[model samples]
Target: MEISLEKPIQQEVSVTNTGDLSEIQRVLTELLYVPDDKLKLVVVLELLDYFKEKFSQKDYKINFFYTKQNGNITGFVVSQIDKEYRSYGMKCPTFGWLTSKDFLSCKLLMGECEDFVRKHKFRKIRGPINFPKISGGIGYQTEGFEAPMLNGVAFNEPSSKVLEYLQELGYKKDAKYSCVEVVESNWNKGNNLDDDIVLKFLHPHEIRELRSQILTLAQNSFYSVLADAPGGQSRFEEMMDSYDLVFGNRFVIKDNFDPRSISSIPEFIEAWESCDLNKIVPCCPLAYDRTNGELVGIIMALPNLFQLWSKEPLTHLNVDTVIINKEYAGRGIFSSLQNVGQITSRLHGFEYVEGTTIYANNDRAISTIFPHSTPLRTHYVVQKRILRK
Candidate 1:
């Protein structure tokens, strides 16, 4: 009788560029899906839909690449090239939605990304940064794996070995971010701001009326400090649109007081009445020039609705964005706006306040925004240097 021996399973890794979103979604869902968790899945699918919409619009250069192992989809990454980033320096494209089954797969997929970078003559590659500003996030999860995933925050399996693989593949840390939580007891009630600065909770009508001003404030406040400016009216409107769908009229305007008493504007009353505070406490607090009514600072936060989706008590408020005009930087506007939002959240029974993606080097955010708070989770944005041909 002839001796029979079974051959070992061969390792197969292949990467391809495709427009098939369904396949992309399948791979991502398989990687991220949690049983009995509909909300997280919905958010994931919605983000993919946003990518699809953007692709259809052809507004930006978005490329999708996926890797297969032994004929099974095992990894994927999306590379986005923004025209505006070129003016700042090199057209360093951002790679996001990175998911993979194993370290080998991860390395190979990133190899494909690097090849794309080389082919395009881009100077560097950065990310795991998703986009649209409103729904995207930066970096890979390096700490706090036990913490529940928040909406718009990046997620990675602690055991995936992806970060390690990146390090081995010549990626270095470009930036670090922190997610922080502040409890009611730690509320930093700010010192008195200048008399000419007026802080108030912006009503819905006021938000609509002041949309242009708010966008301007965002652009002016964030342009210098951030890599990407908030840009033109269309981008700001896109963010607002995302906020509306994500929050679902749950934003708390001023207080529990009668709507008519707070605003004479009919639209304001109707909008305020539509909010269901029992579910979540969301607010937009603003500091504006008392003299000219120009916006000086702003803070926006919404309930941690991910808690509800996880079947946990909704007791957390998430501070999404904080912007203080450069001219008014040291006027305590940042702290004051946060204090007001925290007070409002506490009054409505929230137990903790969380802020996401605070850059490690942001001295102003660290010193002024939440001085004493420690990070709940930490993330690192990685980059690779590519030599020009």
Candidate 2:
């Protein structure tokens, strides 16, 4: 590796393998706020261990870059090529590295990453895809200071100079999604809710009965939001599987929702039960209108306890999905269902709820959730072609 700043200095820039795990940890610790004692760091180490076990004997390449002047280290970047998906079923060729606050070194690091991918014969790239969304993405570009950086999404508080420099280097806006925080203090306490819409906390037995109904709602509403990405159905299935299907303790199902009517519920439940629930904590779901003796809508909440390294625990809640029947849309039933879910979150000690929506969602979620909240984070999905044959 050659190191050169504008106006060209004679200092040698060298690229090396991340031979010292401690050094890597140190660099990342300086960049991110994750505690050394947290399970998140252990999870990251476990992921690296998995990569080593799977790819160490293969043709995979992992390297790091360091800039030194007069034998003093000032900056570094880590890069690795994985032959298999680490997690979340993503199989793209990926690179992860760190760069100093130096502008030229950052540019050089990104160029080296692109070159490495092209040399390895990859056609496209998708990342800074971190192990979990909570660990910020590698390729994040920050624009303004008006908003705080979102936990879990890709982010960096680069100076305005760095932003202009990165744009001149060829990265562009990829995908934009908002992360909103709904504090417990913001709950709609004064608005009178409908008496007929009853909220029930589901147990394992009721979960078994309503499991099929929940899956029906997930699959029906699937294509409406996730139709564009690669293997969207598989990704959705994997997410559902993470909750152990219907085993999440924090799940809400509408009353008397018929599971038999939907075809995918049985299989989902069967798959969910086969996993070890001990590794995953059960989330509470708020099932609405069960007392009305009819099934209408189901809202499920998955507590993201494991990703606490990204944000404070109980400060954020990832709304797994809110499924409402098409016939129940115009009657304000969805609002009622959401109210129950939010209130349940407050009772359980959660401060905010977050979820994703595609370009086609027609502002249904935004109109309902954003008016009373602050934006926490934003994510962009960018793609680029490798100029190789």
Candidate 1 colliding pairs: none
Give the Å shift of residue 284 in candidate 2.
4.9
The superposed Cα distance between candidate 1 and the true structure at residue 229, in angstroms, equals: 6.4
Give the per-residue lDDT of model 2 (tens digit) for 215-248.
5565455434431222233333334544453244
| Candidate no. 2 TM-score | 0.56
**lDDT (Cα, 0-100) at 361 in candidate 2:** 39
Error of 2 at 381 (Å): 4.2
* Number of clashes found in candidate 2: 18
Error of 1 at 157 (Å): 0.7
lDDT of each: 0.66, 0.48
* Ten-residue stretch with the least lDDT total in model 2: 263-272
Q: For residues 195-253, what per-residue lDDT tens digits would candidate 1 score against the true structure?
A: 78776654444455677777667766665556433244644455455445444345344
Model 1 alpha-carbon drift over 4 Å, by segment: 1-3, 9-11, 33-37, 83-91, 132-136, 184-191, 227-239, 242-282, 308-314
